[model samples]
Target: MKTNYQREITKHIETNQLSYLFIMILFIVGLIFGAMIVVSMHFTQKQDLLFYLNQYFSRIDQQEILNHFDLFKSALFSHLQYLIIFLLLGLSIIGLPIIWVTIFIKGTFIGFSVGFFVYQYGFSGLLFISAAILPQNLIVIPVYLFAATIAMIFSGQLLKKLSGRRFIRFTVEPVSQYLIVFVVLFGFCLLAALIEGYLIGYYLPLVRQLIN
Candidate 1:
């Protein structure tokens, strides 16, 4: 009887595996699509950053702008932190659409930033983004996707519970898993930021100068 029960449980898990896999795949696909949208927005908002920079240069001294780079980077880091936290919390409360919108917004920002670079330097702008943006995104996107997947799964389980599914054991594991993933995600984000600040910020400018 025990062996039969074990076999049945294993079979159930196996049957449901595809659904979980599909959710994960959707998360990844959503991320890539979000990135592409952001890249597009970058192109659309091409002159925005340069215009702001130009105005700053006109008003402020050149040395001031250079000196403020660290401040600017710090502000960006803070914003990213807030955005991550907000999105994670929001995902837990709201439905998947809310999470999707959050991701889309991120993608739009990436697109706008990339577009701005392209506007400033043409193809060379791509290199700037590759150095600065790619490194952090490599860490961040997967984390977001995983969080989104977990949230969606949790929501689905909640729905199942609501729909009179007595056999389903809806518990705290999903939330706990989400918290663990969130911590890991933030750690990766911190590492990515460090790489961006140290490696990309320090070396990429030199590379650009060399290429130019």
Candidate 2:
């Protein structure tokens, strides 16, 4: 059964290779654009951002105990909202462009975050991000990318059906399978939220010490 599932997944990717490539490239383009935005920021703008970051760090230091549960709830809620958008967009035939925009925006935020860290503290910035950001994003990034890709693919399928280009495989999998995939993806999002909430909170103090 596992073998059959793997084969089906492999076949699915093979069939949608072009869509995956296009989505991946779109995300990369967003990342580059985000980095460029960092480079182009005015000195004052950079300082303002840096000031805010410092204030955040100071709060973390001053607090005797962080509310990790609150962090988990916030992260999970954000992930849920993002996934809900993809789910709705996947159901709509006109959602293709919006799905692309969503992926790009996600990439842009990630790129901007890493760019800001590296720009501010050099190697220490890299260390801080690796500890603070990369842990959760290691799962979160792929989850978003896969969700976006599948959403686009499903949207495309809906378009084909509307255009009278129906295929047997479309009928075979149907909306149920598409929805199942999103549900499974959401489970991964849950794991990412845990990492974001608990693991990152644990790591931040260490990262703060290293950077300081």
Candidate 3:
């Protein structure tokens, strides 16, 4: 406990954790603000968001669980769309704004979806939300933030490199690290997809039954 090296390592780890937390908070503020924007829009704008939500939820409620592989493939396809965006965010320093924009979309969609479900179904919608959204987002949202944070760090490094600053490193190491994180994050996404495709199918009908 008294060793200087151990203390230094611990200190560095704690500092890094704090820095990540700060950045995550900033990202969350942006996300929540985006969500609030959807929630706060005037009647016409809300009508547009609501129009889509109506179609989406009606389709969701009417969906029949099909073949396992087909369902998994479908779920995987949806997750992959977001995965591709995160992959791009990690690869391109210029895509930080893209990440921010995607985060906004994510937040806005979740907010609008939740608001709509609650409005349409009242208390019963919470069960639908729990069944459909909670399981995957539990993993996916962290991965989103984690990927965003890594991209933010790399973007800063790229800026330093552009300015010809010394003691700054860019390129391969960061990219390799990003790829590693991407692989791990995608693995989690795969798990979420599996849960969404197969497991949730079983549970969602049961949830609807309880609602009835």
Candidate 4:
């Protein structure tokens, strides 16, 4: 016999699967929009980006000019901004549209980042993914997706509350559970931030060396 915990987990998964799918589809749309913008840009612009990339990498290797600490700070700040947006959307009652927008913006950012990298570096840009995006994003994207889905789910429940379909008793358990979920997801975001700060810098030099 399945325990109550097991059944609850299964039920949540089944219930949220469609919502997750809907969010992912929106992300895909955003990702495509981002890539399209890069694709349609002028060749001169692409060359400029290529030149800047080469110059930046040369500085990193020969001059040791890139401040890893500053890079980490920037990366962490960027990530925390993402985290805060999703967290707020997930916890708020009327945040579904914003959540979708966040998904699109995130997709656009990644699509542009990856697309521009490839456009500038050609085959070599693929190597940059190993160091730059692959590591942190591997953890971060899934967490964002989960957080978004949870936000949508919560928003739906809140709608039900408004309609007098459920939670009419004003119980503390549900609110406490929502807070606990946020705490756990925040901790996960911190973990991703640590990886961005410490590990990604180590990967960058190695990846650049291999690609060059």
Candidate 5:
């Protein structure tokens, strides 16, 4: 009996998977926008960082270099925070369009940022993006996906319960499932942010210079 119940719940979850798919589709759409931005910016913003590098190297000053690094790190972290919060709020809402718009906007920002780099450095820009952006995304994308899934399930459960529909008791199971997924998503966000801030922020500059 317990096994059968669990099977039913799993089936329900699977059936509702389309909610998650919608969000993912939005995310890919956003990524396309972001990539375009990166490509556009690459052409417009390409400057031989050599001059800037020479200027900084000539000064041979640790404090100024560290300051610039701090500024870049802060900017990166701020962007990450903004993206996470925007997506979280969007997913928490009860409408499909709201979620879709939010995901597209997020993807646009990402696409533009990456596209800017690609336009500037070509394949090297791609490398920079993979190093700088990909690490955090590994965690963030899945987190948002789970959040969207939970939000969808929660909304469905609420509707069914309120409608005085049959099988109202089944709503509790989905609610519990939503809560669990939310917790996991939150945890992944934290881990992703740390990796972005410390590993990528601290090390990427050195890596870039070394390669150059």
Candidate 6:
């Protein structure tokens, strides 16, 4: 049986399903755009990227000792930085477009990375991506998308109030709810960081072999 809190949350989701769908489509479009850009890269550009990528992998190979703590810190800090930005963006009307851009850019970068990996190393690259990238992103991406969607909805509410929509009061209730949701999302970010920092090392040998 669902508690009242769960019921309310479900109702809210049902009400905002269209917004979620729209944001998801936007992210997917960005991903496709990124992959397409990879396809269109000039040979010289690809070579430059390949050179850097090989250098990076070589460094990692040489440094066989991985610092799990440092990786965790890096991943957690990165997630928190973006979450803070979304929090600020949700506070104002002009931030809606910026939030959209942030989400799109995130998707684009991920797509481009995956595309480049597969382009360069064939099946091995795909395996590396599945092992190293997907595990963390399986949690991270949804958390971010949820944050972006919530930010969008909050900003929309502010816009409504600004436009003299009397029924939609810009009250403490929404603000508190927004903060609470992000706080919960932050916990998920920590889980993602753990995966990125610790879980990926389990596949270290495979990743190194693929890169080389």
Candidate number with greatest TM-score: 6
Residue-level lDDT of model 6, residues 1-212, one tens digit each, is: 99999999899899999889988998998899888889999999999998887787776777654677888899999999999999999998999999999999998999899999988888988988888799989999999899999999999988878888466544688789999999999999999999888878555655778655
Q: Is candidate 1 or candidate 4 better by lDDT?
A: 4
Better of 4 and 5 by TM-score: 4
Clashing pairs in 2: none
Q: List model 2 lDDT by residue over 123-187, tens digit each.
A: 99898888888888888888888888999988987887788854534465678898898899899
Model 1: lDDT equals: 0.58
Segments of candidate 4 deviating more than 4 angstroms:
1-3, 51-55, 62-70, 165-167, 210-212
Clashing pairs in 4: none
**Total clashing pairs for each candidate:** 9, 0, 0, 0, 16, 0
Comparing 3 and 4 by TM-score, which wins?
Answer: 4
Evaluate all candidate structures by whole-model CA lDDT and list the values in order.
Answer: 0.58, 0.87, 0.68, 0.78, 0.62, 0.88
Sorted by TM-score (best first), the order is 6, 2, 4, 3, 5, 1
For residue 40, give model 5's deviation from the true position in Å.
6.6
Residue pairs with clashing backbones, model 1: 38-107, 38-111, 39-111, 41-111, 41-112, 42-111, 42-112, 42-115, 43-115
With a 3 Å backbone cut-off (N, CA, C), the pairs that clash in candidate 3 are none
Q: lDDT of candidate 6 vs native? A: 0.88
lDDT of 5: 0.62
TM-score, each model?
A: 0.61, 0.93, 0.72, 0.85, 0.65, 0.94
Q: 1-212 in candidate 5: lDDT tens per residue?
A: 56986997688768877877777788888989777654454432445543564575444333344443464466456545644554445334354455567668877877776766566567886887788678888777676666655555555546556677465454366546555655656666667766765677566555465324
Ranking by lDDT: 6, 2, 4, 3, 5, 1
Off by over 4 Å in 2: 165-173
TM-score-better candidate, 1 vs 4 = 4
lDDT of 4 by residue, 1-212 (tens): 99998998799989789998998999888889988989899989878877888898887677475466776677767766876776677667789899888888999989888888776667788778766778778887887888888878887787778888455766788768766776777677777777776777666667787557
**1 or 3, greater by TM-score:** 3
